[model samples]
Target chain A: MDTNTLTGLKSAFQVAPSDELAKVICFALIESGEESEIALYLQQAQKTLDESESLKLAEALYQAELHETARNVLSEELLSHKILVAKCLNESGEPEQARKLYCSAIEADSSLESHALNRTFNVEVKVAQINNDDKPKLKVVEKMDLASVTDMVRYRQDTSDFSDVVGLEHIKKQISKKIIMPFQRPSLFQKFKKKVGGGVILYGPPGCGKTLLARATAGECKASFFNIEISDVLDMYIGESEQKLHTIFEKARSSTPCVLFFDEIEALAGKREHSRNSSSANVVSQFLTELDGFSQNNEGVLVLASTNVPWAVDAAFLRPGRFDRMFFVPPPDKVARKAILEHHIKGRPAESNIDFSSIASKATGYSGADLYNLVEMAADEAIDESIEAGNEVVISNQHFKNAIKEARSTTTEWLTTARNYARYANEGGRYDEVLSFLKKHGK
Target chain B: MQEHKYTMASECFHRGQIDRAIDLLRELLAEEPNSADCHGLLAGCLLEKKRLYAAEYELAIALNLEPQNALFYVLQARINLLRNKTKSALESCDEALQLEPEYLDAHLLKSDVYLVFNKYDEAKACIDIAANLQPGSVTVAHYYGEYFFAKGDIKTAEKYAVDSLSIDPQDEAANILMGKIKLRQGNLKEAEYHATFVIIQNPDSNSALRLFCDIKMRRNIILGGWWRFNAWMASLSNVQSSVVLISGYLVFMLAAQIFEDFEYLTVSSLISFAWIGLVIYSWVGIPMYYKRLRKELERFSFNPEF
Candidate 1:
């Protein structure tokens, strides 16, 4: 079209001034490189056109070789517009900027990957599907069966031994003589007509290594360790708890030399006289039956239970042939505390000059867990110091002192309650050990 | 090496084979000679056998072996109670409590002594504290019932007894207390029912048998005659009998005053002599009843029913 004809047609359309005609005039102005006229026409057309119509107009303007105007009109309002603007830029010889826009568009919306790449390629083929393994490959992962993993974890043998425990020499010795010895010398126990398998109740304050001690006992016996959580045995459905308990015991019996450990046994074996309902009473009776093993053999199944409150346990459970052997696990003594403190700080970053004895002495009635917490608090203090100094700072004696001030012993309340029982309620002198402990402490 | 014998002893004890347990515990002790648990257990056997002196010796050795043992202290308390050394028994219970404050058996034993001493307030405090500590404890509930019964709070005592029975229907102490409460309430049939139930469970329960006998004597008294005397005799505890004797002496003194006014010296003198004789009989008989009850309790392996 001649410049004279374009000017004639634009004047004719300006007189009519219809939206479609104005759009036509705008396209013509764009084709003829009439930048000022195209801007004026487009500004008027934008008010009338919707978003999609405006996009189409921008595309037409790009096809008419108005790259800058098309990019300005696109304004990233639509994904397709973005692809079009990138294409216009690439065609107009600004490939770097075009590639960046394409990459960004795909990044913003992952579903646009193939479409963005295809628009860049100007073809139907997806770049990702191309056999270009040389570029990169996603890391491959193998799926695992959860049931098998659980079985592996549940049936695994614990290799812990009494040596692994920090202290409690007397308790360890008693457990070995009563429990491990029978396992090692079955014939000796058998000749005495003693049932190889029997139950023992371990009572103490919380976090005092009761569970850890049980594992060590199992390790000492070289038995398969089956830790039965009270939650696992207690079911919401009636008779289910008994069934679960029965299954656990049967499993232990079948897996000869299995150490069936029930932590927090008081919940499972609370006094029948204290039971509020027949369901709990039934559970107790079921437990008693399992312990008796009237028809079944429990020759190598060692049932060990631990509780923080032995006084809550049923009296019948303490009778002969049941949980006859009872041991009261107390807070670690000074030597044990020292050992525990050392264990907590072994791999941690601490100063060589830090006095463990000072910390141990400060933690008079601390449990093993309490010691671990103290070390953690000290390490945290060191971290704050390190951050303030803008450099690495080792845990210092000062940090430990700070931790000591912050972390009080968790065993005090337990001991206070224990003293009451030990002092007034020690039926049959069953709490002699507790008495001896109180005496030693000058309590 | 003698572990098997020890096992045999424990098995016998659990099976209520007291004689067998005694023999095996003896044999095991002879072989090992240093087992504190064996000694303590042997003392328990002797305690059940009613051999108070032998039990005391065995318990002493056990305590010597494990001096700080709270259980041994409780056993020694029981032994003292059997010997009628109320003071010594209370001291032993205190020592046990000193060793283990929350020992339920020790608390129960202390409560029993308080009941026997007629220290109703002390008994109530001990059992109430135990009850508060372990609300659902059958032993504590039973002791609280006994405390109420001793205080003559029959209604509350019956409630506690029923509460205890609700927890453990076959509990011997609860049933015996129930029988006592029923007898006090004049529910003779209910009293007989509970007594019979307790006897079925533990025929040697002295409290139960006494309540049964008294109930029977009362029923016979309805027809009058010799049954009146026996019923009257059964009606009073040691403390009640002492009070009766004192009142009888005062009444006789008034009668003497009336007789002296009329110049009846011989009748006044006779009344004075009878009153003195009655006082002496009461002084002897009251202790004998307690002695017989304690001896009967010692004969059984179970906890002694108050």
Candidate 2:
């Protein structure tokens, strides 16, 4: 407190016991208004002040009172001391000093960067929160909710003919659980009894009804359905792609309870690993954010995401809540084949001699779509035969037997991929069905 | 007086040690009775450092010498915005813009001034002109993040921040901005991580420390500050600062108290505490009072409302 005591302390404890001591001394000067004396003591104080003392010193210098002296104190070159001085200078209306210290901070390290240092209170706030009276009536767009939709909706078909898909009642029930019920009464889903909206992946061989399943899922949601293809959003313009993404999400969010079906997910949701170019990476990143960016307000929209290449989405998206549910759309087993055969033969003039059950049993590995085509090809052959014989007729069992010889499933490669996926090779293959199917048939 | 072995190291700087030079100039201002060039140099240095008060002092002295220098007002405005001083910075920037509307840096500086003032629309407008002046410049991208972060869209805030960083990875403001967002998102480890880098760059970094203190406060347990490190605890923890300061002083004091008859440890601890006090407050308990206040800041979590 006295000059003699100050002198003794300066001589006795010159180097910082801790940086905090320096901070305390700076505070002492500010409170005492003894700038010259404080400066002298600061000069005499030790450089290797231990961390605590340095922090204390920094704190003192940083406070409003000692702020002016803190600038001089910061000259000590100790990183902690310097930071303290900069802050003190900033408080003491020495912004120039503060900025210099900030620059010095830049000068101190080769790596430190200043980003959005100008990042405001939160960000680019366009509209301020208005009180009830100050708030203008919002035109609550009852049409579309784009924030809930991905910018890239895989657009292939209108799905008006989408009603053709049948069978898989449980999968349909899953669609209701996964998309419909969640939208109808979102408040009912509880933890334990909770549902984390996950991205849905329909992985199956090409003709195995992946698209059909997606369509039914979309239709069942009964929300505004937008089938945004990859090409619909991505463009060459620098800002255009972002705008398109913005518009798509904006539109989707407005249409709450909307179902956006993305077919051939690999076209857009493909893993960032294979994308060597920045544009593709941008597309993926923007697309990922759009899909997952639903703030707490997005109530009605449920994304019915499907991908043949389920392995391609970014790893970040697959973490926890993004897209958790994946279904394995495999080739029809004998039972499914029989059901498919029964459905396809509904209006056909088949005689009792056809023996369709035996036909279905023979058609293992045939997907529903593939089975329908197989039967159609068989019918075509019969019609061709009848035309030559100059008679109206049914496709006989013998004719189908002949047709079966010419028919080959286009799903061999698809089965291998599906098998790999089902095995959890890319995480797309984590299903037990693929392992069992492969165990029975061999990888 | 000493022979210089490392001339390069001895040299002021490649970019120049403007602040140190300004400090020397301020010191010289006491002795020099009338030196306009010195004042101008000091102003220039202060302006370069973004220290507007000192810079303005020099500017007033310099304007008396040469009234037609448009760059001085421009620099003043730049200082104003960058320094968080609005009225003067804006007025100065406006004068600069009016004199030479096409002046690119001046325009950018005006936007910067507005941005610092939280006048986002004006800042954005200024940036619009600057963008027209220099399309896709890092400055525009930089402020783009700034405005967005201020607006509260962290996703886009991060997006623009990333964009700005991509252009100039060394941009300190962008990095700090990114670190702030990281801090707000409940990732103190990352916030501390980034702040550490920023702090290291400028030990005198007010912004970095502000961010760092905030991050440290968000932690799950006790560390740093008073009971930071001790001989026994230092063995377990790697934060060398704690190992050295918080523990070292207390140990010295306890030893001094315990061995008062011997007297060395007590005297040593007293001296250690005094040294810190002098460095901070000239032997006053200024750091103590601030500690109580800082405790409040340390408690500030990202409630979004704040």
lDDT of 1 by residue, B1-306 (tens): 587888788778766677899999988888888888899888988787667788889888898889889898888999889888889999999999999898878888998898889998888788877887788977888888888888888889878887787566567788788878888888987676677666555544556766766776678855333333433554555766678767888899999889988999999888888888876766575456546533432221111110
Residue-wise C-alpha lDDT for candidate 1, range A43-145, written one tens digit per residue: 6566676667767777777766777777767766577677777777887898888777776776677676675565664544434566655754443333333
lDDT of each: 0.77, 0.61
TM-score of each: 0.42, 0.37
Q: Could you tell me the lDDT of residue A356 within candidate 2?
A: 75
Which number leads on TM-score? 1
Q: Which residue runs of candidate 1 sit more than 4 Å off their true CA positions?
A: A1-153, B1-306
Worst 10 residues of 1 chain A by lDDT: A144-153
Clash count, one per candidate:
26, 98
Residue A28 C-alpha lDDT in model 1:
69
